[model samples]
Target: MMKMNDVAKLANVSPATVSRVICHPELVSEETRSKVLEVINQVNYKPHIVARQFRTQKTRNILVVVPDITSAFFSKVLRGIEHVALKNGYQVILGDTENNIEREKDYVDLLLQKQVDGMILLTARQDKVRLEELSTQFPLVLACEYIDGLNVPTVSIDNVSSARKATEHLISLGHTKIAHISGSINVILSRDRLRGFKQAMMSQNLEVESSYIQEGDFKFESGYHQMMKLLALEVPPTAVFAFNDEMALGAIKAAKDSGVNVPNDLAVVGFDNIKMSSINEPSITTIDQPKYEIGKKAMEILLKLINNQELHNKKIVFKDELIVRGSTRKEIDVKETLEMV
Candidate 1:
């Protein structure tokens, strides 16, 4: 019920001054802005968001399309995006595609129709033709995931290098019989991680056994099932590397159910370093991608695109860190490594 005019009168300032104080506080004088803010707080004044949107021709709404909302990997990223967006007086609308191309496309269409000012996508599965067409009409930035050979602006970590580091950690831990639990091969991150896995094996003069690698859908259940298959192999792996923390946790559960002693019998490592990783019975060793920073940077880039500002490149790659924990003990040395088929 509080009005801007009432605040302006109480502050003894003109309505235009009050408008600047609310919309562009930085442009107003410190003393005047302070007075207006005091009156605003005293009256519990609320801005008419709808009226402002109508006047500014901006919805102040951004759509974030994620592959899965339930994954802890995305929770920090969303927090970062929300932090930056709220500070800039914008709102975020979230859409979960569940890694389904059709669902992704549907959300894209719906957000477009809703006239959101910009969009940040963590699922970039749209066909090249469609993506090119959409990019021409709207401000869009890809986050976490990206389409190969596309010019869309993206924010993500160096997947290949981080994955290689993870594998190398296992190799240095006296484990040559290292198996990999890969995510869906179609995703770029999955392919990159697989490539890194092979590269690490070859670097150490170890044989790359195709049978030692299994594919999962990046889900706990898929990881559980794939790990079971790995355990049943005639020559079981001495250590396993999962594509993400969620899968690694699932694999850990499977290992426990089969009475396998972690690290002692089978070392395990995961990626993404989700919060749960540290709290697991045997804390997981994994790669930590700056999930929150990735989200914040993606939104910052999209905001620039919306304003038609020049961006140096369409691709932005973030750095990753390898965090060692109890799941992969550091006491073991390379001299004790076993030879594999």
Candidate 2:
């Protein structure tokens, strides 16, 4: 019931002084601030946040665009984003595009309409021209994926190199007949990871068999189907590499359904070491991407852009780690690692 004017009148200060005391405390004299605080406490006054936002021309709401909200990997990343956003007095709005470019564009329209302060995209599907144009007019940061020509800041690990390292690990373990379960070819990340897999095979003089490669939509069902197809092949792969832990877990299931024991009969590896990777029946050997850090760092970059600060780097690439687990432990001779090359 108590309003700003009522507080000012009770404190014997003008309304403008009261506004300054509430919005910018430092702008008010100490005496004026103390008096206003006493009145505010006595009245239990609550500032109108929406009105304040309107006056300041800032919603203090950040939009985070993700490919899929159901994916555990993106959920983990969102936790990091929420941590940073909350600590800095901002709110986060999630936009799950479900890998649809048109849906992603709809979320971008929120930024253009001043409904959100800024945006952090997790593997954006929008065209380069539109995204580039938006970047010039808004604060935008890319997380987990990047486009080469866009000058917008990005936070991600090197997908190609990480994929190469993962493939190399399988090769070192003497998995010459290796099959790759790749993500959708439409995204740059899938293409880069596929390239890495091929490069590693080439370095070891292993043949990259076309039949051994399968395309997945980065879902558990796709992984299950692909693994089944691979198992039915005349010359089945000794080991399988999946683009994500979801697929890796799927492959493990398919191998078991076919009465095959993991790591013994068929070795399997995955990328994006999500929480389920460790808790699975046979834990997956995987490329550990810093998912949480990527989200946190992406929000940090977006904040800097919103504050009109110069970014130290346009592209921030975090390092990926390889975690060996129970999923792929078929050991081979150390000398064979050399022989394989």
For lDDT, the strongest prediction is 2
The residue-by-residue lDDT of candidate 2 on 95-188, one tens digit each, is 9898998899899999999999899999666788888899999999999988877878888999999999999999998889999999999999
The per-residue C-alpha lDDT of model 1 at residue 118 equals: 83
Q: Residue 307, candidate 1: how far off, in angstroms? A: 2.3
**TM-scores of the models, in the given order?**
0.89, 0.86
CA deviation > 4 Å runs, candidate 2: 2-46, 331-341
Compared with the true structure, the alpha-carbon lDDT of candidate 2 equals 0.89
How many clashing pairs in candidate 1?
0
lDDT of each: 0.87, 0.89
Q: Which residue pairs in candidate 2 collide?
A: none
Per residue, candidate 1 scores C-alpha lDDT tens digits across 1-341 of: 87878888999999888877766554688888888888988899888878876776777789999899988999999998998886565689999998898989888886568568888998877888788778888898888988778878889988889889999999998899999999999888899999999999999999888889999999999889988889999998989999999999988898999888787888999999999999998999999999999999998888788778999978999989999999988445456654321
